[model samples]
Target: MKIAIIGAGGVGGYFGAKLVKAGHDVHFIARGEHLKAIQNNGLVVKSILGDFRVANLRATEKITEIDQPDLIILGVKAWQIKEIREDIRKVLHKDTVILPLQNGVLAADELSEKIDKRNVLGGLCRIISKIESPGVIHHIGVTPTIVFGELDKSITERISGIDRIFKSAGIESTISEDIEADVWRKFILICVSGLLAVSETTYGELRETKETRQLMIGLLNEIFLLSKKAGVKIESDFVGKAVAFIDTFPPSSTSSLTRDVWDQKPSEIEYQNGSVVKMGEKHGIETPINKFVYSCILPRELKARGLR
Candidate 1:
């Protein structure tokens, strides 16, 4: 497959390296020091599964420099999806597939708005990884996983082919029966991310503190209600499953959203918590807890974007 990875940070860098190692023609679109390091010395991936390096990488900062790709793994944040629409349109072929691996639930729909919906696939990834440095990707935890399917959840030739490619690279892969529902399932896990950013409670602290736990419940409940309003058909036990999964994390574990906010970097706040607020208004649902979280994070996010 001719693959172009849009944001070659942790997610793109790690997965793109695996594809390259599997002998796929892959190009990385990155910027600044990361681009320099990969071009000069290749990309290194440190993983518990196994560590490997890809020397003589095919890399460039512009998508236009890439040949028309068979597949483009959209690894940038949900918020940055809009920023890359024109670049993607310029290089896309009719048969080119776009898989969005953002954490948020709205990436597929958002991407399809700019491109043809037939070319967009509903996708999400499960992995804990980051750019350890300019040239290095460190896989910290989780079995790196990719769950994806057509928006309508039908099995097709390209879906199977993509599945084969991922498994060939030793990634845990699944083709969803109801990708919309699965996307919302993954979204439930993100509730704590922005909540922790606002509440500033450790996982242990959140579990022990009654007030914090109440706020967490409020956050999850709002999403569940909104999911129903949006007609996404999320499971009845959504909140319970979300809380159970959250409880399994270590005390010090914090989401990328919380960390990004603390680090004063632009984050997925608008698409994460802020999306809940926006969608609630769209669906005529009330989301006070989500609203509060989004409002609190907006000032910092604006400052980070230099919009404040």
Candidate 2:
């Protein structure tokens, strides 16, 4: 398959490396020093599962330079989706599939608005990874996994074929019968990202303290109520499971959102917890915890963009 991986960050770089290693024709769309490093040194991924490199890779900053891609995986943030979709459209064919392995729930919707909805898939990824340096990706922890499916929750030939493509690369992939529920399940896990950023708390800090743990639960409960009101199906008892999952994390583990805020880089503050708050307002639900978290980060987020 001829694949295009946009945004060669942690998520994109790691997954694209896997595809290229599997002997697929992959085009990496990236910019800055990262793109230069890849063009010179190839793409390197250090995974707990295994480490590998794709030498002499096909990489370009211009998406138009690549020929038609059978599949396009968006590894960019949700906020950058609209901006990148124009370039993505230039290289897509009629049956080209677009998968967004972003942090928030809204990436697919954002892409579908400008690009063809028929080509966009509801997708999310579970991976603890980061760009260790230019052209080098580090999968520090977690069993990297990809979950995706059609928006309408129907299983089809294309879904199975896409699942096969990822699995063939030794990626743990799933085709969900309830992709909505699956997406929300991951959202439940990510709700702690804002709290961790604001408090600079680690997983050990949040899980070990009764008060902090309960506060984390409160933020999650607000999201649960909002999801229920919005008519998105999530496992009824998933909250308890989510809390347990956090307990399993390493003591110093933090989220991508927390790291971005700490680095004063642009983050998904508006798309993650902020998305929950917006959905709450739309459904006449009071998301006090999420609202508080969103408000706490708004100043920093605004300042990050020079909006202050």
Candidate 3:
């Protein structure tokens, strides 16, 4: 398969490197020092499962330079989907499948709005990894796994083919009956842990405090309500299930949002918590907790991007 990875960060770099090593044709669309590093040395993945490299890769900042791809995996920040869709569309053929592993529920919908819906797939990734340095990605925790399916949740040949491609690369994957709910399941985990962790200091801090724990639950409940109103097929008692899931994380651990807020880098706040808030208003549901979290973090996020 000819694959194009847009944003060779942790998720893209790790998956793309593995695919390239599996002998599939992989081109990475990257920029700056990271692109130079991949061009000169290779894309290095220091994974807990294993370590490998893909050297002398076909990487470029321009999309038109590459051939038509069979699949395009989007690993950019959630806020970037709209901005990058046009460039991505330029490289698409009739059969190109766009898989967005962004940390949000609206990724497929957002892409479907701009690009052809036939080319879009609902997807989510479960991986705790990041670009540790130029050309280097570190997979620290959680075995990397990808879960994806069609918007209508059909088990088509394309889904089977993609699953086989992932399996061939030794990557774990699942074809979900409802990819949107799967996306929301991951979103709940992030928003609750992420918002509370950002509001407090650490997972330890929130876990230790009953008040903060309740706050996290409050935020999650609002998300649950919004999910139901939006017609997502999530369980009614998901808040309880999500709390148990959050407990599995290490106490000292923080979410990508918490780290981004601390580092003052751009984050997926607008896509995750902010999306909940907007959806809440649209559905006439109260989301005080999400609103509070979004209000507290928006300033820093804007400043980080120089929008302030």
Candidate 4:
């Protein structure tokens, strides 16, 4: 199948390179040094599974250069969505499926408004990865999983074909029965960890301190309640399972958002924790813990961008 990867950052870069290595026709839409590197050499993926390079890869900054792809994996940051919507539309065929592997819960709906509902699929990605450098993608975790399904919950040949391709590339891809719920579950995990990591000093600091740990759990509970109120059918013990998962991680484990905030790079906080705050307000739910975390991170965000 012809595949196009938008925003060839860590998520797209790693998965797209793997698909290319698996002998699939993959085109990466990227810009700046990362695009130059992929065009000059290839997309490099350094992961715990293995390290490899796809030398015969196709890459371009504009979508018009590539043919219509069967699947377009949208991996851009949440902030870049509005800017790239039309650009992304240019590369899709009538039957092309756009799977957004973004962090927030609103991307699928937002994209659906621009593109045909049938052409957009809801996706949730579970991986600890980042752009280690301009051309390098570093995946830190063992499981690199992706879950996607049709917006209307219909199973189609295209979804099956995409699933086969992903599995061929050694990725664990599932066709979720309820993609929206899956997306929210992932958001809860990421936002809780992200806010705590940034608000405190590090993951170790949050996990080691009793007060911070309780606060982290409380923040997660608030988001979970908001999700329930939003009508998402999340598991009852979701928070308990999440806390246990965090305990298994190395004490030094931190979210990518925390790293971005610390490095003064742009972050997706407005979509993560800020999303919870906005949704809670809409539902008349009091999210004091999440609100507190959001407030704490705002100063750092302002400071990082010299807005303070």
Number of the top TM-score candidate: 2
Name the regions of candidate 1 deviating beyond 4 angstroms: 201-205
Q: Alpha carbon lDDT of residue 174, candidate 2?
A: 92
Which candidate should be chosen as best, given lDDT against the real structure?
2
Looking at model 2, the pairs that clash are none
Clash-forming residue pairs, model 3: none
Residue lDDT tens for model 2, 82-144: 788888888889999999988778888888878889998999999878888999998877888
Order the candidates by lDDT, highest first: 2, 1, 3, 4
lDDT of 3 by residue, 1-308 (tens): 78999889888998999899999999998889999999999988998888888898999988788788999999888888988888888878999999999998878888988789999999999887888899999887777899999999888999899999999999999999998899888887788645654566677678678888888888888888888988989988888998887776656667667778888898888888888889899999999999988888888889999999
Provide the overall lDDT of each model, using Cα atoms, as 2-decimal numbers. 0.87, 0.88, 0.86, 0.83
Determine which window of 10 residues in candidate 1 has minimal summed lDDT.
247-256
> How many Å off is the CA of 149 in candidate 1?
0.6
Instruction: Note the residue pairs that clash in candidate 4.
Output: none
Model 4 residue runs over 4 Å out of place are 300-308
Model 3 misses residue 256 by how many Å? 2.4
TM-score of each: 0.94, 0.97, 0.94, 0.94
Candidate 4 — worst ten consecutive residues by lDDT sum?
193-202
> Between which residue pairs do clashes occur in model 1?
none
